[model samples]
Target: MTASREIRLAARPVGEPAPQHFELVETTVPEPEEGQIVVRNTWMSVDPYMRERMDDVESYLPPFQLGAPMDGSAVGEVVASRSAGVPVGATVVHFLGWREYAVMDAAAATVVDTALAPAEAYLGALGTTGLTAYAALTEVAPVRQGDVVLVSAAAGAVGSIAGQLARKLGATRVIGSAGGPLKARKLVEEFGYDAAIDYRAGSLAAQLAEAAPDGVDVYVDHVGGDHLVAAIDALRHGGRIALVGAISTYNATSPVPGPSNLFSLAAKDANLRGMLINSYFHLFPEWIGKAAGWLADGSLHTELTVAEGIAQAPAAFLDMMRGGNVGKMLVRL
Candidate 1:
């Protein structure tokens, strides 16, 4: 029998998860039951939202049980399949956490074509990241022609795609805010943003004013706190704010504070809408179609920062939370 290595939550992390919070253990691979497949994980995603799972709080999704393998999106190759529908050599995407191998029901995994993109891309760009951007732009924060769109975490997986989607949707200006100057430059030069602001620089309000002279019509917020506050201050009348994530406050041990300038929303007559991607899973196919079209036509770009091995997954995750990643963060096992 083959042995597989897996990472499990050893304890609830108080702040950022350290090596002690996770324990790596090896176990014998289990036999695949009927209608199930045994997959060998090739890539795993490490996202900011995973930080929230470490806490024992009531969330849209259940928190990770102590001593259980931490769950997230992953792409793997089916090594053995007992079901007729799932072929042995097919690459698939599933919510199978962090493990070298896993045995799951065929129905729980979706077959993905490796020919379309790299296997890791299934866990990133072509997968949830792209879908999230498409949904948030088209459904959550709809933008019209000549609209000014501002995106936070601008060089990140969802933010980068969201800015591009806004531009494709006919936004006159696509402005983005990233943590560093390099990332800000990449946002303008590589991702096709009309203008990009470095939030790490001078006053956020001043930077935003220079980037978006008229006013922001739609704000795709990924990094909350000051970024959200700045976006609110720069919004035009009737602007829409898509609350995608709050990476800035994800690692805070204390109670995280909301945007201090929230009253600006009422003054601007803006709408702030919270978005949970899982709640809109039923509409994924539609969003995927539009995103695929943009990707195929060269209107959308997918970026990634891949860590070499699963051993580095935790560091990669911590790095992402600390603003060390340029795009989707993943571990290539």
Candidate 2:
């Protein structure tokens, strides 16, 4: 038997999950079945989307059950295996995170090549984060040459990549939004954005207009609500908007209303499309190929906010929710 430490949902949060909402418990893991393997997780991801799963509400994915081990993206080395294909010592990526060790089916664990990038990259830019950015820019709001792009939550894992990808995909200029001046500066200095708006400073509408006087041709929305309204107000005729996330309302207790200026979609002859990454998994092969090359050639860069130890996962998650992290937040075991 293997003793594993795991984080469980102790209680459903009302708003802004605190450390009390989670509990760390120890459990013994039995040997895996004939087609399963035991992975000792080295790195795990803590994301904003996990907050929505804490609520007992209907959404694209099911909510986390109370007092049970919660899961997300994790990268680990297989310590024990019952299948010959996934032998011990193979590094794998799986959905069983928030725990130090996990027993996963062979089919569910993907063997990623560590030679291309570090193991943790699978959880950040080289993994779902990169895929979401690529699909959103290329498909959701295809950027043409000379297009002016705006991205909200522009310092996060997905937004960090989206801003750069937009430029590479042919946007003439890219503007990003972050909560602080430092992050806003990072968008311009590191990720290659034309301008970075400090959303916490003042009016997003006024700032966006100043950033792009001619009007934005594409908007990749991550922080919805006011950001959505602002993007709609700043969009040019025949503009496109990709509704990727709504981090601003993730912790709201009451039902949050969407942008009131939705009518502007018709008035400005613009298009708004929602994105669910699962629907675009088919594009991963192509995205990975291109992203990997870009990364090797120094055209792409990744940032991470690491939380040491499995016990600190809850704190790390809370910090990320409060916009304490500049990029991807990970718990290193």
Total clashing residue pairs per candidate? 0, 0
Alpha-carbon local distance difference test for all models? 0.86, 0.92
- Candidate 2, residues 17-103, lDDT tens digits: the string is 988999999999879999999999999999888999999999988999999999999999999999989989999999999999999
The residue-by-residue lDDT of candidate 1 on 1-333, one tens digit each, is 988887788899887778888877778898999999999999999888889989999987799889888888999999999999999999999998588898999999999877666788777667888888877888888898889999999899888788788887899899998978899899999888988888778898898988887889999989889888888888899999999999878878899877788988898888999999987777777766666666677777878898877667777777888888887988888
RMSD of each: 1.5, 0.8
Please tell me which predicted candidate would have the highest lDDT against the true structure. Answer: 2
Residue 31 in model 2: lDDT? 90
Pick the TM-score winner. 2
Q: Local error of candidate 1 at 190, Å?
A: 0.3
lDDT of 2: 0.92
Q: Candidate 2, which segments miss by more than 4 Å at Cα? A: none
Error of 1 at 230 (Å): 1.2
